[model samples]
Target: MLPSGTFVLGGAASGKSAWAESFCESSDLTLNYLATGQARDAEMDQRIKIHKDRRNDRWQTIEAPFDLAPALAALDGDSIVLIDCATMWLSNHMLAETDLAAAQDDLLLALQSCAAKWVMVSNEVGHGVVPDNALARQFRDAQGRLNIALAAHADLAVLVTAGLPLTLKGTLP
Candidate 1:
């Protein structure tokens, strides 16, 4: 059985999203996709399309590139939301010069109070070499903090590597 909250962490192309999606699909709740990615370029557009193509009509896609709290708040207990890739969401806020601390607080609060089951997918960027620039380093630090918060809040926390899941917190359902 899927828990109320699950945090899925992985590197790029680690199959974390696929694993998260499959976990949600196993549940009986209505699937809700809270997409945080924006198509800023051709490659990004194709990436978004691929994600969309993977999800069928059963998923109710909600495009939330900047503000996710509203969409997350609207879900009911009968829904299971997949917040695909929080890395992009964080980047969107960072690039926009938004108050990241405030934004992260709001997101955590929303997730805490949400009535629906949720599986958040985030990139595990801390496993790589140190970034050469300030911005990259800042993003890495922020993502690490965010992932820690999410994992602390989640009932089940998993790290996906080489398309395999390794439970970090709770038992895998």
Candidate 2:
């Protein structure tokens, strides 16, 4: 059976994905890598490639840059699914100018109902200096709210920084 959900929060290049991968690796189940990123530019393409290169061939990757709920729902059995970010997923919705509230609700519902073990990764975007632009500020606020909502429902919530993990809720398995 899948264990209760886990939420891992951190900043960019802060080893959150690596940590989440490790958490998934701890289990004997097959690893399902649910990539939320979209390589819309050169930098993002490189970043996505780097992440892909780090993962072993055993992982099955699903590129659900916009449809996370359906992606989660479609997966069968008890494989461990690592969603390598909530922020990117949110960004996709924001950029598409979709209904943020409805998207959030759908994402949460999928997480709650998925049969597989899930280790969700999200960026902690609100701890730094406030964004000077309205769009940036809006994104930061949305990210924070998304993290909180996920953490609230997660059985284990961890904050990672400088490649170290600090558990916020439940013991690390």
Per-candidate Cα RMSD to the true structure, in Å, reads: 0.8, 1.3
Clashes of 2: 0
lDDT of 2 by residue, 8-54 (tens): 99988899999899878877888999999999999999999999999
Runs off by more than 4 Å, candidate 2? none
Give stretches of model 1 more than 4 Å off.
none
Candidates in order have lDDT scores of 0.93, 0.89
Instruction: Score every model by TM-score.
Output: 0.98, 0.96
Tell me the lDDT of candidate 1.
0.93
Cand. 1 TM to true fold: 0.98
